[model samples]
Target: MLDALGWGAVAAASLLVGAVLALLRTWRAGLIGGVLAFGAGALISSVSFELAQEGLRLGGPLPVAIGIAVGALAFFFANRAVDRIGGRKGGGAGGLPLAVGALLDGIPEQAVLGIGLASGEGVSVALLVAIFVSNLPESIGSASDMRANGKGRGVVLGLWAAVAVVCALATLGGYALASVAGGQVRAGIDAFAAGALLVMLIDSMVPEAHDKAGNRAGLVTVIGFAVAAALSNLT
Candidate 1:
């Protein structure tokens, strides 16, 4: 259980690091785009290796499929609600989607971490890096955009901090859930995270990165995938 919290904190801390970086320097659009693309690739690797495959190994296709469907639908509706609210709140800046994506991604990601801990097989370095690396660009881009849009530093930091806290706590929740869940349920949880992550990347992160970095984003994303895939092999 402590492992879950510790690992969750480690993963979530990247948001704070990104928030601090945003306050210190203005990141270029191209730079942020490359980071987002790379993070997107890393997330892909995590979904492929750490979540989907492991989920399949745990439970059959039925639960995984069901979980994925549920997860995708959940994200779709929730994201739509957030978009409506954001539209109504007129003063919002551009990076709100990135923040929302990060917040959504982190919960299941951290929960999977907890589930892994409960299984006693240790955590996946690839998944951990995916969560951590992806979080940095989201918080940095969002915080910077917020700061640029006349928001105070405190508000930006506080917002990210809240996200981080929520994600960290999810690890504990996952751990607790794992204690009671069957193999099928665990598999479903893993699939759920992957589904949510895939939708988030397609709906928000990928498009945003492509819009900012153009052709460069594609190469950077491939590189990120290769690197993360290599890390999974190494571990």
Candidate 2:
């Protein structure tokens, strides 16, 4: 449990790191977009190579399919609702949606991390690096947008710090679940996370990257994918 909590905190620390970077400097749109694109690609690879593959191996197809469908729909509707509730306005503007989306993305990933820890197969370096790398651009972009919209540094930092804590708790929850749950349940959780992540990338990250980075975003995305794949293979 302690090990799981520590690893979870390590993964979640990127959120604070990214927030600090955003608050400390003014990042160019192109740079931010490029980073977002890269992160998206890495996350895609993580979902495919790590989450989905393990889910298939452990749970078979049906549970994985059901989990994916449910997860995707849940995130889609919830994200829309957040948008409808004025998540895109005022000083907080982009911060609200971004924070919610990040939470949606983070919880499942960290949960799976905890599961891995409890499984005794040890940690997957590929997954850890992917989660950490992907989280960075998300926080940076969100923080930058919030600052641009006149949100105070304290508010932005506080939001990310809170998110990190929640994510750590989520990892601990996954660790706890692992002791009582069977293979299918774990597989379902992994698939569910993959589904949410896929929707998030398509709905926000990819489009945002393209809008800001133009065609160059495509190349960076591919590069990120390649790097992540290499890591997955090597690790």
Candidate 3:
């Protein structure tokens, strides 16, 4: 449990880094869009190679399918709700979707980390790097957006902090679940994260990137995907 908490915190600590960067810096539109595009690519790579593949291998198609459906629907509805809220507020909802995405996917991702630890793989440095690397642009883009929307530094920081803490605890939850959860349940959890992240990329990250960075976002996304895919297979 302690190990799970520690590792989870280390993984999610990037949220704080992003928050600080957004708070301190004035990001150019091109740069922030590029970062978001890169982030979308990284997440796509994660879904393809890490979560979906692992889920299929762990259990089978059914649980993975179900998990994916549930995750996608969950994110879609949640995003819609957030949009409505932001609409009522008369704007100021730029980075909120990613923050919601982090919260949604973070739990399952950290849980997978716990499962890995419990299975005695010690830790996959490749996985660690993937998680750490992928999280950076996510936080940076999200924080930057929130800041642009006139969100207070304290509010944005606190939100990310809360997300990090929740995800850290989810590591412990996953570790605990490993003792009792079957392969299918584990598979479901993995797919759930993948599914949620996939929807988030399509709905928010990709559009933001293209709108902000123009055609350059496409190549940047491919580069980010290639980099993350290489890292994913390194182990």
Candidate 4:
């Protein structure tokens, strides 16, 4: 229970950082891109180095391959669904759907981190740090969208808090199951998460950053990835 709670708190802390970014207005496009890139790197590193390593340590190549495919497909389809629905406004309010979509998109990566942490001590702290870095861009985007749509600061913060709750619950659940699963199972799961993170990095973060801020933001995105890679190496 304590372990689960700890993971939940970590997840919430990640979301809270994102919330703070969202609530602040002076943050520039380059900074946001840098943050997103940082997150992208962290997500990639965690899945690739830590979680995937543990998963393979327990399972074999087959499970790892299957997990990667599964994770990739899940996020790919989810993204496609988002693109298809992008044209539609949400229940007389569009921002809500965007927030929900962003929140849901974060779940798989966080779950994988939770599972990694559950398996060992080093990974838990590492994932917390990684995810915290990743959540910054998300927070900025969410908060910016809300403010643009005329939502109050309270609404933005409240919505962020709600997302944090979900993140905590998801992490807790993943951590709980990590112990029952062997390395192969974990490896497979990590593969899937890795695929999902890759897709998100390519499909969302990079393009969005480029679209929003052009060349300057794009460079920061790479810097973000480099920082994350460095951190992964440190771990």
**Top model by lDDT, which number?**
3
lDDT to native, each model: 0.81, 0.84, 0.88, 0.64
Question: For each candidate, what TM-score against the reference?
Answer: 0.91, 0.93, 0.97, 0.78
Better of 2 and 3 by lDDT: 3
Model 2 segments more than 4 A misplaced: 87-95
Q: Could you give candidate 4's per-residue lDDT for residues 186-231 as a string of tens digits?
A: 6776677666766766767666566666666655656666666666
Q: After TM-score superposition, what is the CA distance of residue 215 in candidate 2 from its true location, in Å?
A: 0.9
Better of 2 and 3 by TM-score: 3
- Residue 195 miss distance in model 4 (angstroms): 1.8
Global CA lDDT computed for model 2: 0.84
| List of clashing residue pairs for candidate 1 | none
Query: For model 4, what is the C-alpha lDDT against the true structure?
Result: 0.64
**Model 4, residue 29: C-alpha shift (Å):** 3.1
Task: Looking at model 3, report the run of 10 residues with the lowest lDDT sum.
Answer: 119-128
Between prediction 3 and prediction 4, the one with superior TM-score is: 3
- Writing each residue's lDDT as its tens digit, candidate 2 over 143-224 gives 9888887879999999999999999888999899888868798788878878888888888788888988999999999998
User: What TM-score should be assigned to candidate 1?
Assistant: 0.91
Q: What is the clash count of model 2?
A: 0
